[model samples]
Target: MSLSVTKKRSLAALAAACLASVALPATPALAQKVKNKTPAAEASASSVDYVVTIPSVEAVQSSMDEATITDILSGNLAGNAAALAELDATSITIPEITVTLDVEVDGETERGTLTLSNLVLEDVSDGVATSMRLNGSSFATPEGNADMGTISAENVNLAAILGIYGLVDAGASREMQTLYTDFLVGGGSFSSDEFSCDIGAISGGEVRGRPFETSFVEIISIAQSMEDNPEDISPELLGKFVRMYADLLTAFESSEFTFDGLDCAGTTDEGEALAISVAGITMAGMSPGIYPQLSFDGLSIVADDGTMALENFTLKQFDLSSVIATLEAAPELVEESWFEANGRGLIPAFEGFSFSGLSMDIEDQDNEGERIIADVAEFDLSLGQYLNGIPSALDTWARGLRVDLPEDSEDEQVQQLLALGITTIDAGFRIAAAWNADTNTIDVEEVSMSGVDLASVALKGTIANATEALFSLDMDEAMTAGMGMAVKALSVDVVDSGLSDIVLAVVSAEQKVDPKTLRPVFAGLAEGTVVGMMAGVADAAKLGSALSSFIAGKAKSLNISVEAKDDPGLSLEDFMMAEDDPTTLLGKVNIDASAK
Candidate 1:
């Protein structure tokens, strides 16, 4: 049969069962009650009581006939003899149903009782029969309050039930067939007091499932055979077989294994009513080799008034080992080129973990207050490489880093700085590196950050032989080697123009420091430094004379460019470490500064 047609028939059967369970008893009684309440009738007793009984399968079929069952199916399975035949012998007997009402001048009270002794369905053609028996199931309200007794279902075969409705096909697996054979639940009850309502075993109420293939009979027989003939079954073979059976059972066992309790209520405390509740919950799932099994242990929730909390909420077997293994097994899952460019088949994994005690509170708010507060006492996560490819990954990420900023903005701060004679504000940085796997040489590319016109500074340089310098751990050696390495390009651009004077004026005005006093301090420091010495010579040779003049407002704009000679670098080792100013080594660089 087509899947859709099968599903429609299955749903029709389900709907019929639900309707029979609820509406069948009330329909006739409600019609009679309405007839008695008409104006033509005289006044009757203040209360009425009635009892109903649904007869056995054969008696009900004889009374209702084929048309009645077809009507109950709602035309969804019309003219389908096989489906109707399945329901013909299905017996649902309510041995006794009692409903009573008491009417008074001030108020009225209604109570009801429903007792279902057993519901049995047998399909001789399919060679399957299932039965459900409930004990002492009842509902009542005394003094406008509700109370209920324990209800338990026994001998439920879910697979057979589904098969009767044609929901299970012939090709169903052994695992699927075993799901419903011998499923049982017991010790289920609910009660409520003036202050609180409690549900006992609401979490499936001690559910147990014994599949047909793994029946107790088979298990006992295997045990007895092993005991009777010890030499026939080797210890290793026995252990292996036991393990296999355990694994198979776990794969088929998907129901919640256990649940403790649940309670909810609204109670008055300090003349104020507040809602509160607490529940202990746990659940498990089966995933064969990928996970083998997974579960949440000691999971619970509590809430009262303005606060809610989760306690001992732990998840087991949430690690990525299985995921990595799956990916490795199916390399085609991710594009090969993408993995090669990025991680080169490397993946990250973490050890298994658990987190607990998460909470949130809605505090009482005043005129201006935050609505909620949340906290976590501790959070710990650690990352580890599944393969030895950390260095390559780091290098790839470093070389890809780039920071781009706008050259101009209309923000109030930018306008204010512009009013102080600052023009372009393009400011950002980028990092580049080169790694040669063949030679094992690590040459870090140029790292540069530039401010176009605000401070007019540009720095560009490369770090060569970085691996050796970094490993030495000697700052002086690293520095000497760095300075001696090749310089691709180096330049500094500054337009002191009135920016420095404007800044001095603002700082002096704000801090009451005299500009005359600060300027001398800056000029003295400039002349005493090696950089200052270079600047003095450049200015004397008129290399940067135009730029200096423009900063003094002699020209409208200025641009300066400096170049290092063929062997130019630095004499810092002799100057700083040896305390000797090596002028000749410094003269290797040349500067050419000018204005437009």
Candidate 2:
């Protein structure tokens, strides 16, 4: 499933607040007999006194065979729960368990095997396994291979899972539910001709997937009993499902998951090699619809084309409650890209997202050996104050930036920098905006981009009558209504330090003239264009003089603004109406300019 940016954070926030994914601690395994003193050596290495390990548990054994458990798990939860609880074995240990299957590789069927050893389920009583452990595993195929260490879970309750299965099959009793109080994985890795990945230990606690009997069982049963079509599910039933699911999420007193680390490498179809590593990932304090927190630490990716890294990342207050409501209303939308439907704001409304210590090295695919590198100390975005299901206030910031230009480049941008003898840029960027619901306007308070020893440009503007229709998800509706919105006012300021001198030198060289001689000539042309463009709209000469002064090096800054002569503002409709004779309306718009 493709996720919105906010949901992607949720997925990465521990690979889907995978607190819901806290498995039975089953690690990726290879299909070979593990050689060692004991595969359970790590689990047994703990304080527990383990029983003797059997040479192997034959799958042929009818009732007691380990493979039988897999069948019972899927056949009927109602009987399986009781059958498992009745197992006479106080503790069972198996030396090896091998599984075989055929999987497609490169569009061809290839046989694969996964052999696991040191399997132990200890203290099975009252349908609860005090602990379960699988120590070693190796899986192999012609196309790939994988190996893993001990994967263990403690306090596995057969009852915790049966309840959910019971709802689906109508055979499992509430007592047949499943839950594993705690889980842990030593570590593992897998590889194929195309790619490879290494995973660090994963762990979590209070992983209870079964829902409360009163909270969700009835709704689940009703849904399960219905035909598989969303149309067949009543609005009330869909609403119930969403509510019950959310209730199930809220019922969890505690649930958390963490991925200690990850390192992966692969070759793209283009044959470009890529490597990625992440130090740690974690998600905690999760609730249905809204997740309290998810974070990533020390992530880096390198490829033939580019390299990117970040010291840390965090997402807070991830919310998908709005989408849930959509699902409840039009269940069919869920079958489509429902999250993107009209009025569904941002899929999941994330309160904020931020990253620190970021660096990027970008290489031009078309230009061999040419690249741009930069390091950014921090970047942040925050959203809040809802209007028309949209966040009225949106703020963005990026600071402590340093950029390096590739040397000896053929790119025009590079040549311009070289003309100014600029190989690097120290810069920062920021934007702030908010919606004025009372005024029906969107105020762009500021938008700024600046570089040290370079130059700075800033803008402030507003969009009037930015109503709900303007923010509608329907493109045609929004576009039609948008054309009616007024372009209220706009202001721009360009300030130069040494950048003016560099510009003059570059222009002089391009014109084959002296820098001192080009300044006035260039400034004159700029003034003339400004004066002619609007037919003396709002003191054009004064604005032209300001531009001329700055371009001629008589000033270091130029400020300009535009406003419609009519009181409220000028809309896109007005522009379109004037398209046939735009020059006729030029004098109606006022322009103001100045310099210092």
Q: What would the TM-scores of all predictions be?
A: 0.27, 0.66
TM-score of 1: 0.27
For 1-596, candidate 2 gives per-residue lDDT tens digits of: 11111111111122211221222334342111111112354321111111111234433223355544543321222334546544544676656655554433334555666577777777776556789888978878787898877888888765444344332232433332337767788888989999999989988886645445442335435444342344565555554565455445443434788989889999988999999999999888565566677789999999877889999998867666765454445552233243345445435677888999998888766777776678989899999875446677999988888877777777798777876889888888889999887888889988999888878899999878787787676779888877778877889999887887887778778879889998898899999997888654668899989999999889988899987778468877677878887776566677889999
Clash total of candidate 2: 17
Task: Enumerate clash totals for all models, in the order shown.
Answer: 0, 17
Candidate 1 local lDDT, residue 576: 61
CA lDDT of every candidate: 0.39, 0.66
Candidate 1 lDDT by residue in tens digits, 549-575: 554444544454444455333334433
- Candidate 1: count the clashes: 0
Candidate 1, residue 593: lDDT:
56
- Model 2 TM: 0.66
Model 2 residue 7 CA deviation (Å) reads: 38
